[model samples]
Target chain A: MTETSISLQDIVLHFPKQRNIFGIISDFFRKKIRRFTALSGVNLHIKQGEVVGIIGRNGSGKSTLLRVISGIYPPDEGMVHAAGDISLLAGLGTGFSPHQTGRENALLYGSILGHSEEEMLSKLDEIIEFSELGSFIDEPLRTYSAGMKARLGLAVASAIKPNILLIDEVLGVGDPNFREKSKNKILAMVKGASTVVIVSHSFGLMTDVCDRVVLLDRGKIIAEGDPQTSIKAYYDLEE
Target chain B: MGQNGPTTPVLRQIGVKSNPLLAPINTLKEVRSNRFLVRNLIRRDVRGRYRNAALGYAWTVIEPALLASVYWFLFIMLSGNPDEMYAVWVLLGVIVWGSFSKSLNAATNSLTGNVRTMHLVFFPRSIFPVSGVGANIVVTMMSCLIILPLLYIYELPITIHLVWIPIGVLLAGFMALGFGMMMAPLNCVQRDVQHLIRFITRAGFFVSPVMWTAEMAMERGAWGEAALWNPMVLPITMVRHALEGKSVELPDSIVISSLVVSFLIYVVGTMIFSKYERGAVKYL
Candidate 1:
């Protein structure tokens, strides 16, 4: 039997409507809830070293699917199984406090990603070198520009080699040179024997890096197969 | 996709378990596994609190000291000095109340404050409240050091009962943590919960023996017995009794019952938090 790195069976997710105090109290007393489904009847599986790309329009549940696979959001109905440690680079500079120095934020982010302080400290030099923040690493994150923040985020996230790496639109970061460096970093990660699931809007990047691509629309998979075919199908649907 | 090659077991499950008993254990296990994260969070919180302050760490001591002095002046002016030891009594109450309120306030807002981090990664959401409690505990210890000299200056008689202070602090911490855990998740869902907690804690100071003595309540007969149910009463009274070298006025039954209630609150809080933890991010 081929070792499966990640699998999902008929996964579904729903979110309740945002409410004020009055709404919550009423909902509590009425014993009823209204929710909007984000995903439905989603089934997927990845082999140990497969690199899959998920392409979808805005609010099409691409991020939600990654969250479910990473065990952040519980599916309303369905089963999800992911083996090994998974790292999610969802948003820019997650777990980073503006008041904290870059070094401290890196340590904090590393801990949030499940690395011990000592482990992070040992990787500190490499992370700093990779991000190329140089002397500014000691400065508070508030001092960094937008691209600088994204570099630190990417640097800390990529420092540790995760068994499963889930990327959500992080490729659209930094200026040209830094973007090239980050893309290379991602390519190197994909070269390893690790399962990767990436969500992005960049069709060229998806087709270039992903072995396969899945096209999603309105919370359901519409087409999935070779990157070239899926990308074309996605554009055809858009047209 | 239909070629199920010996269906592999999924690493994590999405649905909630029916067994309520297992919830607390699972929550504890999650928190324990993330102890490093919790420690770093606590460190960040404590440092963050005093980050830009000119006085820095001294603010931990100065704030409580200033508060105690203000209460001392107000109470002495209103009711006249009760005894030579009134300052010590007031300082003790201030320390106890400060720890409890600081912890509750921090923990109540913990989830809301860390909403960004919660969305970006997955850890035990309980860690926010738990680390809030830890940060307060560290600050409380620093404040207690300031009070130690006052006790010595007053030449308060030392006794074996002094040991009860730590126990009291510990019980108070657990009670605050329980309340925090219960409120943290709710606060994420409803912004009103934090406001409500603030109101309750503000009103709690008057209801509990923070500025008054338990003897004042004991004089109320049956009302006094009802007052002991507040949970803070026992610990506050214990710390006062320990420092004053007085006999424990709270009966054994009452103490045991209070301990059991605090424990139950903690367990119930964990269960409630775990129940809503996954949903909390959505609300955030």
Candidate 2:
């Protein structure tokens, strides 16, 4: 029996071009909307426990594909099938409020991720320790540096053991030491049975972590194979 | 884990279910699953409102108290003591209206306000309006505490009928939630809906029985009879009747119609909300 953790068949996603408030008001009378296709007729499948790295240039639909797979954006066409609870580490500090302390933000983020308060509280010490914020954990998030915020975000997100994890550009932030620490933490997470899909621009990081690499360009998969071959093809495409 | 090992079920179903009939059931299931998320959102909303204030949660009570006083002065001066306990009546009406207005206002902006988090997380979208209702309910309960002292001071008789006050508040909440669920998604699509609801709610304050009693409307005959059609009329009147221990005659037809309308609004609102909820993030 083949175990497929994630599958997408002919997936298509189109985002209606956003309009300014005034434009929206005028369009209310005009009733016209323009759409931009983010992904079109893309298909992929990942086996259980496979680490797939998605690499693409900016506006190449890398993050959009991750979102579609995570069930954030419903595909305009096609089907997405996945087995297991999925966690998305999209942008840093998506759930954190500037006015809230790091401790409060952790609990809030945990709650948003479907963990109960008691459950989060029980894991509070571990999350704080992993974030390495120390006394700053009690301070409001507005005062934290970008690196500090990224560390906290990654720590809280990885603390929960998801069945499938979708990561997007989160590993590229923070200092070298913390980046290495975060990279190891992610490696440890994927070392388990969890299927992972990471989107990044850094070829070194992608080759370091991914067992397989899928290259996307303008909403289409341009290449797929072992990390070295795909990374080579991606660099070749740049020329 | 092996190829056939049991794993956690899929985190989300990719497409929106096509069956309209099942939308409400799916929404209910989503709510039940995200109950903890809803609770924390309510806490965050209520706490976040007064986070940096010196007075803190005291502002919750102070707001209604201040509103009640203003209404008390204006109405008492205008009518010159139509009823001996008119002050209590106005206070009750104001508090009940407070809950409805607060819920409606909060739920209207709930989705638009949380577009950032909505884009990041994949929980049921209904959590926003539900949490909005939850937050306002907390504020209403806190304000209701003032009634205890007022009850003692006024020497208002506590009959079994007073039990209906909570039921009345709950009904008001349902009405607000229904209206809110209807408007929240629409507001996401159009900024106009937000301004429109604000206007309606402001006008609604005068149109509802917040400042005057049903008896005053009845004194005007046809206008009084027509005011019975407003959804807020029954709940406000019921609360006043419950608190004052007055034997106010509520027509059976009006009571039944009000309840039916509230239920319809709730059912229809949920259906409309479920339809638009999935697409809300797109517009946002």
Candidate 3:
């Protein structure tokens, strides 16, 4: 009954078959190079303020679908219409440079996410606080561990609340304590009425947060229902 | 954060379109909206280059000056002209041609160089190349300052024609951006494209009017006409004309033709870039 916040109609995305220089040169004279279809004829609609979970095996178009909705990967066919600001929390620390300090990379990452530098500056303290990096924020990003880098990325991206937030398998990052903190943060965001989409292999978080779940297998949505039903469907696919 | 009161959802529509004419206008709009990102990127590029070097920013000025001296020495050895004016002339040529060549090469590598950011977030993919052009323009204008000391040393009188220096620099940028927009996408599609760009720019340094004035080439008759085939001839010559404070002896036909070619390249480049950019990611 609620207004649809994001709509996808028969979306399809494909990537050219990888080729070496010799292969490409040969293909130039020969015929067409093959393409690997990542997503094919997928259709779905998400309502405003609803939490949706997408679960799929590796290379089943889970991340690719998220990219499509975020406008990173333009669909080869069909259309994507989203009614609000959308931010995808994949590849955390998007524009980060190892040579730059943690604080500087935070600003750069935030700017890449469409926030102005001044706005990021204002939130720099909050980001540092949430990241718990202490004085290490001034140290170059190369000094940080994988978990530290993930923490810094999450801290900056979550600083600005988006109307629609899509998080990808990033909740498993950082220490167990930080992982719990991030889960609480996402739950808070959902409670705040932000339309949220999550893609994760784990269904425990989905059972706790998602109103409905969509199961994807080899590019198509195979089932959609309550979280319990979709989880059963996913397990059946695995078997 | 979702108060749900008086909310106007921002609509984003994504689909495929075949129109090329609209590419430029769309790019302009994207650039305007992301002006801050462009500015930040340009600043980062300029500052990042000198971050850890002991010489730091001095390298910006010293680099062209050093190249100028080498070329000046070589010209004297080859032509046996000990004229002080020759030193000044070589410096101006080196500065202009260096920036133009670097701009082209930089823009070509721009997209390939920023694959992480390009894939992680969606701004205009065009921003990378455009900022590459911007950073080069900034560096060229700054590097042009070396000309001041050269002029003072040679006691060359500054004239009204000196105004053409900035115009020439900007025109060089425009031309480079056109070529860059066309090449950046392809460079992503094929890694070899970047290597090819490097080779072309290197070879271009000799064939272009960098070492010799268009006037010198013009006196050679057929060689002059052949040299005119390079679009850089006019801008390079224009910068030299500004420094020497001489009338532009270039014929009207060549000037008009160069301008038209530059504009057409820019339009066509954007068209190709916009159409192929989304697909280029597949290769990346």
Candidate 4:
């Protein structure tokens, strides 16, 4: 068996209840503000090269779990151990400035992912080719459509091959042709001994690509099994 | 933390560090390790800011130049007799004060400005504020270039005392970084904190030693001594003194205490930011 790539033990996280200024002031005089739990007592283990899918309704902590595993959010009560470099793909085109050219924004985004400019330059041809942006890469990002921007974001993000890739709802980007191409790239990564964790509402893709699926509800894991079983459980829960 | 290889298991705990006393030291280490990210961010900020502007980077020099000239004119008109060095003095003060206030306000807004990026990836959240200070410092140094021409126009000589200028700039930068780090987290939670900071920095201009020197303040006796405790006084005064090629005239006790206080504030600010930053992100 492959070694465990990600190990979480009883993770718990809470977001402070947001309040207006008046509510906060009144609470200061009367009581402490309350908190809403995002994740509570979540434990999961994934071995190397596994493709794990997380499915849940909105507000069900699907995205929160990915963040916890990637070390974005510090769990309030648990220990998280993961092997190798982790890259999170959430909200593509984040940090992209519309004023910069696609090439410039690509360089900036690469740096955000810990790659140097030289490294990004080396991968520039592949990024532009994969993004299908062609000569348009020289133009300022303000000229790109939303789809073009997301394509550029995905191309740059995928340029660096990470040990663990956590994708959050970004796979459903671009035209169907590009989506298929990106999916193939991810499958190639898994074949190359990388772990993949994806959070998405697209069940058909989840069932087709995932090795295992986990269903979450109200911040707790409710079911875990092969893709078909867990997805069925999710559908039943919704009903 | 990043890993070396796939085989090396990286154990990352998802909560604040257990020891608060070592938090600042650890935060410094984290920031140091991510220096590349900081550098790239600084470049982006510097380049993006000027890319669309008509004057481009020239605005960096023109802004302080215009503000300094207006103040210099007002002072000359008010005092009746013109001090030959007063133009250079006001120029230096305006440049340093511009950097200090921008650093403070930028630091406060740093995290909020980068909230989208902050969530997509994790490095050191402190990098946002650190890079904010850095970008402002780069612009301020560029702004200082305008002062060189004024020195020649005013017919002043460069002296060894001018070495104190960078020191003063850095001291002001460090103090602003500390206060801004503390305010960044608070500003993330309650946006009112930002408006309050804006007001304070605006009021700060009149209270700080920008228009007047510490020598003038010391002449007022105890009130001046107490005013010297404002933390901004020493650095602003240091720059103004260096430009005038005069030795700093503040009491040794006050100087030492203010220096120590700035350092302490930095330490406290780092600790507070590390502790509360995660919580603050939720608010954003």
Best by DockQ: 4
Candidate 1 at B168: error in angstroms? 2.3
Q: Looking only at chain A, give the TM-score of model 3 against the true structure.
A: 0.92
Q: Candidate 3 — which pairs collide?
A: none
Two-chain DockQ for model 2: 0.47
Of the pair 3 and 4, which is ahead by TM-score? 4
Reported per model, the fraction of native interface contacts reproduced equals 0.48, 0.44, 0.51, 0.49
CA lDDT of each candidate?
Answer: 0.80, 0.81, 0.83, 0.82
| Candidate 1, superposed: residue stretches over 4 Å from native | A21-32, B1-18, B157-163, B245-249
Superposition error at B243 for model 4 (Å): 2.6
Instruction: Return the TM-score for each candidate structure.
Output: 0.91, 0.91, 0.92, 0.92
TM-score of 4: 0.92
- State the displacement of the C-alpha of residue B203, model 3, in Å, after optimal TM-score superposition: 1.0
DockQ, per model, reads 0.46, 0.47, 0.50, 0.52
**Full candidate order by lDDT, most accurate first:** 3, 4, 2, 1
What shift in Å separates residue A47 of candidate 3 from its native position after superposition? 0.6
Per-residue lDDT of candidate 2, residues B1-284 (tens digit): 22224644543456654565566577578778888788778877787788789998877677877887888899767867656777777778888898998898888888898988877778777788888888888888777777788789988777887777877888898898888888888788787888888888889999899888888887888988898778888998988888877544578888889999998888888888877776676888
Error of 1 at A178 (Å): 2.3
Query: DockQ for the candidate 3 complex?
Result: 0.50
Tens-digit lDDT track of model 4 for A39-94: 98999999877899999999999888888887778888988888777888888878
Chain B alone: TM-score in each candidate? 0.88, 0.91, 0.93, 0.91
- Cα lDDT tens digits for candidate 1, A108-204: 8889887877779888999999888999999988899999889998888888777778888877689999999998988787665267898988888
Write down the DockQ of candidate 4: 0.52
